[model samples]
Target: MADNQYITIMLQSLHKKEKVLNSIIQINKRQKEELENPSLDPDDFDKTVEEKSELIEQLELLDNGFEKLYEKVREELQTNKELYKDEILQMQGSIRALAEKSMEIQAQEARNKQLMEQKFASVKKQVREIRSSQKVVNQYYKNMMKKGYVEPHFLDNKK
Candidate 1:
């Protein structure tokens, strides 16, 4: 490809990457909403997790290509800075925008993770409560058995 073509491709890839990042942000927002609900369905949450995983995979693939294209563009800009001064400036602007978006996404994701951790802690507490209740019930049954408690034939009969 020609120098201009390479730069054009890199710019397009950057825009695409930006769009993917935005999608991730939206997905994380949805997840946060779901987590906020009191009756969160496990199945629904699993679906969101799957969707996020797929989006991340795509992002990884895009990054691989983007890196190569970025290196090429950088080399071209360095070698012919005078000739491609305008394009280089444009690329810089796009890069700055991408960095800002990435930072925003990172913040949102961190919030989501914290929410998830809180949820997990809550679930663990409930499980502990349930186990403790079960233990009490079992102990009561064992005591009754030890005392030879048996079924009474009549309501007034004590056995």
Candidate 2:
């Protein structure tokens, strides 16, 4: 069954227990009230006694019923308690696995970012060096042409 369904069933069992306990309490209260003030008239006294006896019998029957119900509920609660424990353990295991996976992913992402940054810095350095070399080569070519050590490429191509 689903977790929520189990929880709902447990709640219903608790509600049943509360109702049964309240009924038992009310019955005891009534019995106490009757005992507190006995009937004085002989005829009324006989009638009261008969009514009390009937009430006692009914109370005995109710007590027996309540005992059986209580036992059943107790057994059910014990079984459910075990089931709850198992479910909690399962949830804990799942959470731990998820946490481990998250940590691994985060670590991998961090390493990848670090590697990317290093590569970018290396590329920038190489670009700066290439630009500087290009400038030096251009200066050398211009000086050679002015000194007549080499003909300008444009003049040679025109010839």
Candidate 3:
């Protein structure tokens, strides 16, 4: 599936782990509290024993439940590992595709750049030729004026 979906699933797994941890913590706390506040009424010793026995049975049940949860968590983690392997393979494929596309783009850009440089060089050569021709034309005009073949005009008629 998509990467975001995978992440969402992992987050849910982590939430489950958190809940299990909290339950375990709370159970341990209750057990500790009971141990510390044992019933002390001598006349109610039998009732207290019975109560303690029931508590012990409950604790055993809790322990069994925790064991089952632990096994389930382990199985889930293994499944996650397998799922992640597939995800990593998919990601690698995506990375490779992107890399290939990038390389193709870079090659196209390089070719375009080379073509531009060639065009620029051709234009520059044409400009240089034009400037050289202009210089030669200016020299020819100067020679004609010196030989009295042409006249120069002045723009002094502003009135």
Candidate 4:
């Protein structure tokens, strides 16, 4: 195939990859919302994660294909500097967009990670409180068992 043809294919691959990245970014935003909500739905968050994984798989496939095509056209494009300038520029633009999306996703993921850690900490505190309460109850029962004297609520009728 011609170098231009290969370049066109690469461009298409880049577009597909960009779309996948956009989907992932949206998923990250949704994940952030889930983390921020006081009452998070585990099932919904799980579904979003699973969906993002599938999109990532698609992105990987596109990357592989783009790399293969780029290798095929590398020599020609390098040697013929001005021959395929337009397509090369388009590909560069697509790459720039992809980079921006990637950065955005990274920032979103960082926020989400922090939120998740906070949620975990809150749950850990609750568990500790419950355990402490249980221990106090157990101690009270132990103390009660050692006392055999029954305290009379009403005074004895010795009057």
- 83-153: candidate 1 lDDT, tens digit per residue: 98887788788889889988998898899899999999999999999999999998899887886466677
TM-score of each: 0.83, 0.37, 0.40, 0.83
Compute the lDDT for candidate 4: 0.88
Cα deviation of 68 in candidate 4 (Å)? 1.3
What is each predicted model's overall lDDT from 0 to 1? 0.86, 0.53, 0.52, 0.88
* Runs of candidate 3 exceeding 4 Å displacement: 1-81, 147-159
Q: lDDT, candidate 3, residue 43?
A: 46
- Which lDDT value does model 1 have at 6? 79
lDDT string, candidate 4, 25-101, tens digits: 88998898888888988898899889989998998899999999888889998888798888888988999999999
lDDT-better candidate, 2 vs 4: 4
Superior by TM-score: candidate 3 or candidate 4? 4
Candidate 3 clashing pairs, residues 3+ apart or interchain = none
